[model samples]
Target: MTKYLISFEKGAMDHIPEADWPEVGKAARAVCDEAKDAGVFVFADGLRYDDGDVQHAVVDVDGVVTDGPYPESKELIGGVLIVDVPMREEALRWAAKTAAACRCAQDVRKFIDGPNNA
Candidate 1:
């Protein structure tokens, strides 16, 4: 099996009204359930939007530690789903479902040297 990451960027769903979130959540959860039923769901999670809710731990080559999110990009991962599947097409299908449920674009990529490949 190959592991794939399906993710969306922060603020991707900002245009969605707060009132519609419950429905969206329901839709997304349905997809998650589908994945679980298919036995491809490794893990899934949504990140908190509040900056105060985010904390980062960075280790430098010198072993110094820094706290905070990556300074290079304003966008962060909004949510992610990791699936262990046999084919890329299957992963893309799941990503499409996720995109539809989230009402946002999904970025799908395979992990390098995943699992047994190593």
Candidate 2:
């Protein structure tokens, strides 16, 4: 099985009204449940970015740790979902479902196959 990253940027969800958030949450949860039932779900979560619900940390190669997020990034990933599947097409299909649920575009990419993958 290959692991694929399915993600969305924070800006992509800007158009969703604040009142619809709960319904959106339900839809996204449904997709997660379906994926879990299929035995392909590895992990999934929404990032706590607003109101400093979570703090970001950045470490340099010299071991200097700094509070993040990087000032250079124009958009941050707002959510992440990982699925281990046999093919890229299957991953894309899941991405579609996620995009529909979140009402945003999803960025899908495969993890490189290597010893580090395990």
Candidate 3:
């Protein structure tokens, strides 16, 4: 099986109508259910707005953890899903399904080959 990084680009959802947001949530849940039924879902979750937490963090040298996000940026991670699929096609299909359900763009790309990958 292959792992993929499926993400929406920053500002990708701007075109969606406000009235459709609830429907997007419903669609996302449905896709999650479909993934589970297919036995390809590893994990999936939505993210909460954490910009305040990030702004408060102050990291120090020596890789020490501090009070806030390391750096401030306009764009931060929104949410994510991780899935194990038999091939890239399957991963792309899942991403397409997610995009349709969320009513936002979802990009699907293979996880790079690296050490310690299962």
Candidate 4:
């Protein structure tokens, strides 16, 4: 089994109206349930959008520590789902389902050395 990450960029769903969130949440939860039923779900979570609640930590080679997210990137990971699947195609299929459920595009990528990897 290979572990894949299925995620979407922060603010990708900003256009969604607040009134429709319940429906969207339902759809997203359904996908998660399906994944769990299929025995592919490893873990999943959504991040808080508030910057005040988010703290970034960086450790330097000499053990120096800094705070803040990457200065060059505007996009953030809004949510993520990790799954252990047999192949890339299977991961892509899950990503498609997730995209539809979230009403946003998803980015799928395999982990270099995941839990299932020896």
Candidate 5:
């Protein structure tokens, strides 16, 4: 099996109306629950970026740490879902569900199979 990460960029849902957030949350959670029931969900969580608790940092090869996420980065990851599936097609299908539920675009990428990835 291969592990895939399905995620969305920060602020991808900024266009969603405030009042609709609750429904969006419900829809997203339902998708997660479905994945869990299917035994493909490895992990899922929304980053607490809006709450001021989430911070970013950057480290270089010299071990110098700087306030995170290079200034050039236009976006940060807002949420993450990891799934273990037999093929990339299944991962893409799951990402589609996530995008619809979250009202945002989703990206899917496979993890390298190794101790670091596992």
Candidate 6:
């Protein structure tokens, strides 16, 4: 099975009104339930915009811990789901379902295959 990282971009979610957040939450929950039933879902979730205050930590090259999102961008990673699937097509189908549930667009990408993939 392959693990795909599905992400939702920032701009696509601007339509949501703060007042209607609860309704959105309900929709998300329903989608999650359907995903669970479909057997195509391994895991899924939502996220907030900020990662709190940025902090620098240790780095491997210098034997130190590093802080902040690696390679930061204007749009923060809002949410994600690690899905185990047989093919990209299956993963994308679930991704589309998620996008519909959130009433927003989402980007889906595959996890790099490597020795540590185990």
lDDT of 5 by residue, 1-118 (tens): 8899999988888999999999999999999999999999999998765456537777879999887544864567899999999999999999999999999999898999899655
**Which digits, one per residue and each the tens of the lDDT, describe model 3 over residues 1-118?**
7778777754566688999888878888888888889888877776544555444444468777675443556345455677788788889889888888776778777876666347
Q: For every candidate structure, what is the RMSD over all alpha carbons to the true structure, in angstroms?
A: 2.0, 1.6, 3.3, 2.0, 1.9, 3.3
Question: Model 2, which residues run further than 4 Å from truth?
Answer: 116-118
Top TM-score: which candidate number? Answer: 2
Worst 10 residues of 5 by lDDT: 47-56
Regions of candidate 4 where Cα sits further than 4 Å from its true position? 114-116
* Model 5 residue pairs with clashes: 57-68
Candidate order by decreasing lDDT: 2, 1, 4, 5, 6, 3
Off by over 4 Å in 3: 50-61, 64-75, 113-116
Q: Which ten residues in a row are the worst by lDDT in model 6?
A: 49-58
Candidate models: Cα lDDT each: 0.90, 0.92, 0.73, 0.89, 0.89, 0.74
Q: Which residue pairs in model 2 clash with each other?
A: none
TM-scores, all models, native as reference: 0.87, 0.91, 0.72, 0.87, 0.88, 0.71
Ten residues in sequence with the least summed lDDT for candidate 4: 67-76
Q: TM-score of model 3 relative to the true fold?
A: 0.72
Which of the two candidates, 1 or 2, achieves a greater lDDT against the reference? 2
Leading candidate by lDDT: 2
